[model samples]
Target chain A: MMDKEKIKFTDEELVARFQQGDERAYIELVKRYKDRLLNFVYRYLNSFEQSEDVVQDTLMKLYTSAHMYREIAKFSTWIFTIAANLAKSELRRLKRRRVVSIHTMGYDDSEYEIPSEDFDPEKETTSNYGEKQIQEAIDTLPDQFKTVIILREVQQLSYEEISQILGISIGTVKSRINRGRLRLQKLLKDLKVR
Target chain B: MDCYSFDKVISDYIESNLSAKQKQEANEHLAQCPACSEKLADMSQLLGALRTLPRPVTRPDFESRLMARIERQKQQKESPFIHVFHEYSRVISVAAAVLLFVATSLFVYTSVVLPGSPASVPSASIRSVEPAAALPAAAAGVRPEQAGGVAEKTLPDTNRVQNPDYNSRIMMVNE
Candidate 1:
């Protein structure tokens, strides 16, 4: 019965309750956001395992930093901001490790294999092919464009929400999304021709 | 509208964010320009694909794992003071209240109640006798023990200086 009542509360209200040390409210917030965060982080990182870790870290941050949330912004915006920052940090860390590994690889190291960035679209068929191509196209975009694209298109967040999450003006968000879509369009066309 | 101008506003047109005049210009450009029309169509398709991308779900144990981590965090966050306080908060609070009550009672007894008590009467009387003790014994021709009474009796004349007699009395004392 109490669970149903909790369900009726809005995300902001749930966060408010969590701020006041209500454990159930925190659980409800987690339940509400876990899948959404996973989707966002997965699109950003492109690895299920890593994305899961990022989402977990994001939630852990939420748990520890609930007091930092202000009612000035929507709870979703704040949580997504946290998830996006973590995902970006993880991406940078991965890139650093990749660079280090490449530099450290010895010519005689038989176990070392350089990872391939190529995706074989021939292996994907029909609906899967389109999705794969779109994902690859998205991956080709710069981080600024990719973030706005995913937030606007995949997560269907508002311009204002994306702006708040990315800490940019709404005009910048709009421009980035427009340019990102244009870039994706060009990339998908190129991929199709190939 | 030229292809360059249309390109700049195409996204806004697709989102219906353009002003009426600008949107109309875009519509006219799209109608005439096959390349721009195709571009718009492709963008629309891309948006659709993006919106329909498969959402991944976390593992079934995700919540349980997260909860366990939260529990661990909660435990870790408890400093020694917080831990001890949490364990014995009621007793500590009660003891604190009792201590505060005793301290307050002591303060009131000393500051407000004690001053009016019979135990303070002797000190009050001693304070009152201080002025009498300050009177000169030689001036009153009395010993220190009898000075209080004699000083009270001679109080009026002490203020009136009978110069010669006072000088003679002082000489007698010296003698």
Candidate 2:
């Protein structure tokens, strides 16, 4: 019998409990972070399936490397750093496995296509294309701007935390967010004009 | 404040990052300039929309699925010591092969390649100093002093000097 109230602890407290071998604390941490991380990674990688995989790897790292977690940084920052690195590595791998353009071959081929099984065609069709347009606009952003936007807007993390996770200065984080939002604004305006 | 300065810090102003003086300057510029004001409105709206974008949902069983995967991972993991060994297993195997090769080469050189006889040793020079007169009739002919001459005559090549007398002396000593 576990107390539901214990789940209300801050992430740092829960991580401390987890380091002390409290499995329930680990579950609580997962419950608190999984959705936010999934969204952040999905926006970064643009594939729901790979985002889920990256999140899973990040959590597993937390579990196995609990002893390595220090109290100096926010747990969210540390976890996001892991997830960001994993996402970047996955992106690099996808780059290496370049998908041959459909124009290259006479016939449509799915074998060399990277499988994104979690993509929901039905949902894409239902939203009157607002969500899809926004997603596409976001997709057009360079990796740095895309990451800054996702972390700032989606995760709602503070500039300091983002700077720590990105290993950049706070000034850099702020400027990047400003530039990203400006780019997003321009993209959205263009989309609306059409 | 002119439009140029206000435009540069509009984002900071919108996000409340501007100081009081900078904020006042931006406000004065926005009051008179319709273009700057409209731009500010659009930028704020854009920021609002971005903030309001729906958060993507995780599957309902996300936690259970993750926990199951974690359990599998834990079970599959090797023990710490074994894991360390497994990580360096390639290097360890390569080093072992190199060491075995060196030891084998040394053994072959000492036992089969360098010595003329199995009984010949590091102290072969001491044995060679023994008088041929003290030798048995069979081994007397195989004097150490004549060894170089017999070897040179029979086989000039360095590797082919298998002295028959040395082998016979070794066999006799063994018997």
Candidate 3:
């Protein structure tokens, strides 16, 4: 049997139209990916505004790379791969500029203000210290553990997807996730996790 | 706590990341063991916390500004090599008209050419060069029958069936 195309017309047809100078298809693509890419980029940059810039830059890259878009993976994975790389590069740029991670460090996670009615079997504090304490603890983790944790927890990606995206063996992915969780537990040792 | 040999499998068991066989073995171990159960509970709690960390929201106007910049930057980043390739495709039909001219042409060249088909498939024949030392010395200590020949100018080249010189050489050797 002929291989049913992994990529539908919705995917390639939109890209092909963009290549053929249909700026409107580009618009549709931007609309489709903008928010999703923003979320991916936001993970890298603590600032929402900077993530917006990253998303823009990533889209421009995708448009020009339209012809290069071979349907090798789920478009979501491919696009997020680009977005993540861009976000990382942007992070590096800020590092070069010496924008101290004080933003990352001295976070007023007052915004994480959990509407404190209580949603759990155990009532946990929604204090800023808890967010900072958790962030500091996560930030201290080795980059390998840190990345897997963020991808699995924050991005809510599957272990298989994390394995493919990070180019690690599945065992390594599982190990890192396990190790990261253990570390996070150690960081929030006082918190009731159950 | 009873120290178990399969502590390495703890993470695997807690996550249910183990294969069915591994899970069965781990469960078997846990059924009789309480230490493993406590460890499993702790690990499960940690895993639950990690999976439940709140997903944050993206700042507004995040999409539109990104789209606008990508559009403008898209043109500057447009690859010139792609255009050159597309243009080169059009030049092919021009070849049908240009080759129609055959004026008197004296093509001069100086090169020793080794003639062979350009498209010929390659094959290699390996001929072994055996040294005379490799010839086995038989019972009389001269040489074996199978690898008999140790080529000498004095010895008759009797292997050549068509050569008349073979009979003279054989007679001289016999006498």
Q: Best candidate, TM-score-wise?
A: 1
Candidate 2 chain B has its poorest 10 consecutive residues by lDDT at B148-157
lDDT of 3 by residue, A12-77 (tens): 576767778876767677777776665555544555556677877778788768777766666666
Can you tell me which runs of candidate 1 are displaced by over 4 Å? A101-129, B79-175
Kindly report the root-mean-square deviation of model 2 from the true structure over all alpha carbons: 9.1
* Residue pairs that clash (backbone atoms under 3 angstroms), model 3: none
State the lDDT at A64 in candidate 2.
93
The model with the greater TM-score, 2 or 3, is 2
Give the DockQ (2 decimals) of all models: 0.19, 0.17, 0.10
Q: What is the lDDT of residue A65 in candidate 2?
A: 94
- DockQ, model 1, C-alpha based: 0.19
Q: CA lDDT of A52 in candidate 3?
A: 70
Candidate number of the best DockQ: 1
Root-mean-square deviation of Cα positions for candidate 3 versus the true structure, in angstroms: 24.3
In candidate 3, what are the lDDT values of residues B1-175, reduced to their tens digit? 1325446677766656678887777778888888767667766665565445444444455556656666555444486665565567667556644544322121111111322222221221011212333344433466423344432333333333245455454334333
Q: Between candidates 1 and 3, which one is better according to DockQ?
A: 1
Runs with alpha carbons beyond 4 Å of true place in candidate 3: A1-13, A16-24, A95-133, A190-194, B1-7, B28-39, B74-175
lDDT (Cα, tens digit) per residue for candidate 1, span A87-163: 99998997787688898978776432222224232234333237678878878889999999999998999999999
